[model samples]
Target: MSAAPKGNGARAARTRGPVHVIGAGLLGASVGLGLRERGIDVTLEDLSPTTVALAADYGAGRVRTAADPAPAIVIVATPPDVAADAVERALTSFPSAVVTDVTSVKLAPLLELTRRGVDLTNYVGSHPMAGRERGGAIMARADLFVARPWVICRDEATPAEALTLVEGVALDLGGVLIEMTPEEHDRSVGLVSHLPQVVSSLLAARLVPATEQAIGLAGGGLRDTTRIAASDPELWMQILGANREPVVELLDAFGADIAAFADALRDPAQTGAKRRIADLLAAGNRGVGRIPGKHGSSERFTTITVLIDDTPGQLGLLLTELGELGINMEDLRLEHSPGAQIGFAEIAVLPEVAERAITDLVERGWRTL
Candidate 1:
């Protein structure tokens, strides 16, 4: 959280302004940037002077001064462990302002605040399911919340005006709001976000001791699976620790599946071993189908892989030709290997236009894979 001195041009146009962001890190700076661009007054605050300066210099917002008016909402973007402290401070500092937090785990902070006997009527816990592989003001994007799930954990005691103000900020930042209780939000994120980070990091950790040749053989699949392993471990440590109960339960179930699969693979000679393996793999397929986006149901769309030269403007040209052909690309994934002369662009399109998309690309002197 930070305090940047406010500017004069902010308007109460669509919604309210004077949004006090208390942590000028990734989420905090991003919220400031997003709201500032929309003509809303955003003040940046952080314990670190360099962080607040960096975030303000990046045009997130100006510094806050003692003369600044009370904000309509205070967004506490602190780490999970200290989020409750930040929220309590915000509530105390601005008794009339609606305070919210964007920390990953919602329940821990809510429980901590409740246990401390803090006033809860104005506090709304939230988690915006958006981030890059990295953190900091340097990586903050104004569009970070666009089309992402922003979970609002509002209790019955929360007033309508407070909820509206919080939801307004979410919608203004292009977030799709989803309402959940603190417990529901934590449990859901444990299954979807926290568990995946643990899995990805552990999976990537396995490659550390491997030989160079084995590492060289890695491709898109390995990269995709291990990508989040690059996330900030110190931050994740606090997050995973704060929401340990649900995450541990998920890990236990996941570990059991892994052990069962390994056991089945060890004894193909057993009567039902092969069947068990196939069933597990098929179950995996079904599970993947349920994931949103291009990875969703296979029957919903068709994917065409096109080869692209490792040169400037090659990908742009392919995309340009797709537009010229009037082919709507539903989703896209790019895969390139080190020192390779070509890259693969997997384009997802409607099933009806799949054959046409491939034929059109081939006719345009493009290679298809």
Candidate 2:
């Protein structure tokens, strides 16, 4: 297990009593598992008894009992549809506790609570930007939030002690903390997270009526673009609905961009048509370049593709050889043809070592592309 970061911020807000997690789903279970790793007491609850039991079985935490004292922290990890209700209940149920949530949309729940005239002093909103396409207690992992951004939505009225407690839990679970208001957080995610999910789903939906021949020509670009389209639609419906205003605004802007690109592509003979297309494409390159690398920095690497047999041990042997060569791989991806006996292993390495790594692999009888 990894050690929780030691510092005044983290130390000041150490968990005093059992940390109660409502909704034993992926995020809840992951929180429990991570805290348990740090020897903190965690108690779990869920609408479904089976889910709570399963998470407990997976080492997340045990079910809460009536005899247990009021918790020091309450993490509501329910679905977005019921997130506001859960947060309200948590705040009322544990009046002295610092209540926080892992809901995707921040504004809706906060507004809902305000509409209900619920006291919000003890509540803080948070979103851990880490999840699998698939979710549930079965998919929970202690290190799920490691190196991931965890946004904390705090208002001026929010107490410092409450904020500190929430940040401590996030840091203890290996998340990089970011502070943002509910409005700022919602608008930001509408562009980065929600927009991508919608675009990916729309792109993948096109494949439904595609000819087999056309589908067979798919490559890494198609896979990378549509990967998140496999996410649960029912879950997305709640998220999209909760953050409807911002997402709709984003969709309108993106649609206009798409229309502009289509117009340019359809009339290449027009003045600056080709230039418009190139500029749009170049803008995409710049946007991608801004995405942070492994530890929140913009660094680029070179990728080398090696051809290998489809046999089970072939890929393992190739990786073993690379280790022996003392070459560190930054990333690895595999691509295979449907009926082919060979596949490609794309290995990312530092740009300075790419040539030497390629030469070594080629000398070891590996073919490169």
List, residue by residue over 1-369, the lDDT tens digit for candidate 2.
246533222544355558999999899999998888777889999999999999999989999999988899999999999999999899888999999999999999999999999999999899999888899999898878877899999989999999999998998888899999999999999998999999999999999999999999998789979999999999999999999999999999999999999999999999999999999999998998897773322134688899999987999999999999999897788889989999999898878898999999999999999
Clash counts for the predictions, in order: 17, 0
lDDT of 2: 0.90
**What TM-score, over all chains together, does every model reach?**
0.83, 0.84
Q: Model 1, 210-300: lDDT tens per residue?
A: 9998999997689889999999999999999999999999999999999999999998898899999999999989987887774532434
Candidates in order have lDDT scores of 0.88, 0.90
Off by over 4 Å in 1: 1-14, 295-336, 343-369
Top-TM-score candidate index: 2
Q: What is the lDDT of residue 38 in candidate 1?
A: 78
